[model samples]
Target: MPHTENHATHREVELLETLRAQGGSARTSHLADVLSVSEETIRRTVKVLAKTGMVQRVHGGVYLSNTEALDPVGSRLKIRTKAKGQIAAVAASMIPSGSCVFLDVGSTTAHVATGLRSHRDLKVVTNGIHAAQALVDNNDNQVFLAGGALYHVEDGTFGPETIEFVERFNIDVAVISIDGFDCETGFLLSSAAEAALARAVTQRARRVLVVTDVTKFGQSAPLIACKPRDVTAVLIDKLPDRIFHQKLIEWEIEVVVVPDSKTGKTR
Candidate 1:
């Protein structure tokens, strides 16, 4: 007998093939219209694809998954140090004194950890080894490391173990870093394991803030970490285009465009 085919899986495969043919970007609404399902359903399916590394979620749609590998963590750290530093400073300012916060593991989140080192009586729970190292070096605040499988590329820990640890604590805020964001996909990450951790952290926090640079906009990653509607705020280096800005407003997500003090530029 021939192998049975699941219609949902079949549709998803068809969608991926379509995305590959279209140069890697498609509007969510358009895809929904074509698929004859609700946009929410389409979005959820896309998130699964992102987690599996088969497709990248870009602004307004998804991208043909990239085959080019990312650079070493150390190299990436040097490339975006300044922008990440500024983003970290802004993210740190959002935390109230003496609050419990969850910090994601990434260069930008590491910057936030550095910026927050001086704040007194703050409790920080993190999975990033670099972030924990930064806090340990400063020795001014309380820091807890969520132990799990370490992914060298992110210089942090993730997996089921980390998810369990995060669930045990309720955080006042979560500052997450994203590989990219589009009005459609909200927040994207490079790995499915990282995206799982992000989703778990977002659920455990009272307020979730996505901290990223301007380059994140219009770009897509293989994993969808969160929907644009799930976040409370988006802190970026520049404002996105008017259309995307309006879409975010419609979703009730507050967009904070922080000017780059060094260059005095706005998105």
Candidate 2:
């Protein structure tokens, strides 16, 4: 399907969601008014969405034709909507233009890629194809993918080459995901190769932000990819145990406790 950076397309998607939420039907003028966009833009979006079978054009409005098609990313997206969206939004806001970032693989990190779509002049290196696709979605960011074996389960690259490939870039911020986090044991990973790749990026970046949902807190994994001292900060849906928080402070690592619906800054 054709894509554009036009704000109208974004509005159209939002309009469709609004329509679905409001009994699956809405007038074009209402959508235009809600989006603060021109009526012409709404008409154009409606036409396109209608052709795609995403919406049906009625006499003076549109109705939902079909919900989004099911796909691999769908289920993971549903797992932590509020937390991931809030974390991604805040993380995306933290990125500066022209900054070089390293994004690791995971559903949460993919959301970070989504948040980064609007950024300009970014150098984003990633192991996840989905994350890399998201970084360059708007065609404004520079994206690089790690070369190696594909780990379908994680939807990313791995093996020795992927680890070595990541070591070459000097990243500004390394945004990584986690399988487990324990205040006493530090951060953990499910796969050794993923851990190796993450360790390389975390060590190389000027700063590191560990982004994960609350589910990772106190979780267990075999590989200890990093410790509190290895990262600049951790971003999560809520604070972990106090001992965990104390250990981070002792290591000079910042902790950012975010709500499931709100963005945040390090505290």
Candidate 3:
């Protein structure tokens, strides 16, 4: 089966959500009951989710991967650091010093915020507390943080208030992050709140730039961030396969592959 088409099925999401509600781990039989499915069915879904690094299967049960836990900010920051930094460098270069920018709570977007630390006089809007902290105080920049419920899992804020605050800005560029992207889904996020904010900014911003590493290329997430038509560019650490590359062309999305610093050549 094609990965994109089969990614994050409704059953899989239900299973994961149930596991989370059960405190991030559960017995296989219990999961089968909660999802109202057979034990074999639960095993099959767990196997698939495990392959995607979303879960871990043990003797007779499964648990959410540390990277998939409710509070995953630290674990996420430790993953693909080099690739994320390279992509962030490319994304930061695209923004001028005095432009209005929208950033998000994803780990990759946190790296992008770091890259922008040196840029002065930026008008920034973001839900990531870390993102806002990174860009403030170094320069005469203005940062508006979305207030409401704090999403401790990703260490960000989101709610109707977050969405309304984001809609208030006419952003020059919205630099967001994603959990997955493919020809079929365009861009995907694991958090519904983050996805809502992404959608709001993509509509209001003049440009929407997605900052993610190559690992997300073939994966899937529960929420759709935006379609390819809404994105202005994608900054990544490496090139995607030929099929996905062609899809980017078809969608008229700009692909910015950050060069490998070791060789100083585009990967």
Candidate 4:
């Protein structure tokens, strides 16, 4: 469950769209006012985009880069941090006390790991180096990092040995995060190894929960992890438009649209 820039924030996405619309360049002040954030924050976000080759930062603002889309985890952590936090709180509620949970790698799942910081009597196993590290300190919660090949950029472990190692545990709930999921195609992801890891863990869990946000809807990826019908539940932020994805519920997959904790708004 390695994270990707696929979870980019609404502001970042809007900025990119605005840049594209403005013939590949825009003023930083204009963007800050449009996004209602400080100029410093906008500049910081631009610097990250510039470093990632997604944009070229000019004196006043940025221009779109010709480089291909790079969905790195770090960029994603900055994007949608709040929405993912809200989603995490809801997903964390599903795990009962003393449950054996399989936490996967992904920015959203990382939030879930953070949301669980106060919980006690939980056993956690994960392929994510970050997720494993986030859960290791609790006196009541035990953490295990499945051993295998380390994918540095994705911050995940994978391979046959890793899959075999994870299969040995009887997990109460498999908490997974994915990219590019659709009601028809189910779970699709950018990395084959991460998708393989997801499939392997879900195969052994008593229940499977796909924790994701609306950004994933209708996107495409090379690998299909699982179908909606196969998952036990899907925890998502309430998207403004869900009429087209109603079939997902018809598939018998429970859908939980989490509300923003601060605003108390589902949309």
Candidate 5:
């Protein structure tokens, strides 16, 4: 049977997810058995994935190449879908139409772009391809994509040129996403290049909004994206712990918790 582009892509994503679950490397035979496909099929899927620099082939298995950076946006969109949707909705509510917004390359930010579709006019600046694609063709919105080296793994532009491109815009609100958070660190991201870009956007924007899920709490990342004082507000799916909550109060950062959709109450 011939594999259509969509079907092959779906199989590739499933294999990658399985690899992540198995600690970023898996035997070809094991992957074949788990995915209920032939070893030849697994090899073919991995061949396509490897060409994109997403995976590396070994003697009898494959390993993910970029473990340091955040997962690809496609894989991340599948994670915490409900939580991200709620956060995106709350984030959209904060920004009025015709606002100049800066959205970063985070998966949650992509969802926020979707939420902004109903607005009449929006000036959207972003490095994330996903966010730009979502908001490009709706309600007279203008999307400015930062130009620089494109990182295919994260599906966003980065480097010094990207930063310079964003600096040209006067951002009304900057919506960011974090990989981890803590009282001391404030917000965290896995990539240093991305962290620098986030810092630049935060400095340029009048209001800085960090959108993330509660799972990031207590986790740690190498680079601190921004301090708590730099943030205007945070939109999350659930409440943070006591100590973290207290710190947000001290920093005067507004905390907006999206209620659980099923229960209509914040957790």
Candidate 6:
């Protein structure tokens, strides 16, 4: 069939338009059975839509891209303050004194930077403007900011230049945050440019630790930052479902579940 101006297959266009009208959430298996195709085909279709920013993939399905706007950093800091703080504390405790560390941009990572303030003679390199600022305010640690174009939404710097700078140095440890995690795709972030920079940092680090809240599990973002196998450890508030947990363990990924102290509960 001749391709239409939309540049999508007829089924793809049909699915997108239907999702646009009825909302993007749909069951892959149900769509497959309804369309008389395999579930893998449905997943592929959704991935394409997600990459093009036409849809946002949720835990069990996809959602309209515009359903919820990306929260600002300040708002995000408030939303998951306790969980993020605990994750940051756990991440900080893992780092040895006077080591070189790479911190990625994100509210959670900013918390980690705050936790690292008391550590002496630490060399901190980061792409996050907020993390650099926090380190500077502490005035006790050495901080290097990767220079590049600032992504306002993410409040971080990223580009080829920044990635090149990160590639030059070998880091003892790297603490990263992601928007999502999946057994098949590994850690996921919202932007391709950010993911590229993150991958560079991950490559240079001897030990890579991913710090994220449990809510990140099961979500799929546009870019796959790094595979679980690329990292040495994962620290999250809690594990999600049993099947996903088992999958990570099967892959030999060390999972650390941090409990919420206030509630004294595991999320």
Which pairs clash inside model 5? none
What tens digits encode model 1's per-residue C-alpha lDDT throughout 60-173?
687656532244455566766777787778788889878888888767778888888878777889998777777764545778899889766667788899999988886999
Higher-scoring candidate on TM-score, 2 or 5: 5
- How many backbone clashes are present in model 2? 0
lDDT score, candidate 4, position 188: 69
TM-score for each candidate, following the candidate numbering: 0.72, 0.68, 0.82, 0.71, 0.75, 0.75
Stretches off by above 4 angstroms in model 2 are: 1-74, 137-139, 259-267
Residue 142 of candidate 4: its Cα lDDT?
A: 93
What candidate 1 gets wrong by more than 4 Å, as runs, is 1-69, 137-140, 262-267
Question: Which candidate ranks first by TM-score, i.e. highest?
Answer: 3
Candidate 2 accuracy as TM-score: 0.68
Residue 131 local lDDT, model 2: 89
Over 1-267, each residue of candidate 5 has an lDDT whose tens digit, in order, gives 212212124577678767866768999999999999999999999998787556799999998775644467888888888999989998999999999999998889999999999986899999999999998878999999999999876799999999999999999999999866767657876565788798888977999999987777766544568767679999988889988888888899999999888899987
Choose the strongest candidate by lDDT.
5
For candidate 5, what is the TM-score?
0.75
Q: For model 4, how does the per-residue alpha-carbon lDDT over 81-159 read when each residue is reduced to its tens digit?
A: 8888888888888888788999887888888888888888888988887777777888589998888998665677888
Residue 137 of candidate 1: its Cα lDDT? 42
Residue pair clashes in candidate 6 = none
Per-structure clash totals for the candidates: 5, 0, 0, 2, 0, 0
Error of 2 at 45 (Å): 59
Q: Model 2: per-residue lDDT, tens digit, 35-138?
A: 78888888888887676445689887887753221123435767767788888888888888789999987778899889888889998988888888776647
Model 6 segments beyond 4 Å from truth? Answer: 1-69, 137-139, 262-267
10 residues in a row with least lDDT, candidate 5: 1-10
> Order of all candidates by lDDT, from best down to worst?
5, 3, 6, 4, 2, 1
Q: Higher lDDT: candidate 4 or 5? A: 5
Please write out the lDDT profile of model 6 over residues 31-102, one tens digit for every residue: 676677887887888888777555777765766564321555656667678888998988999998789999
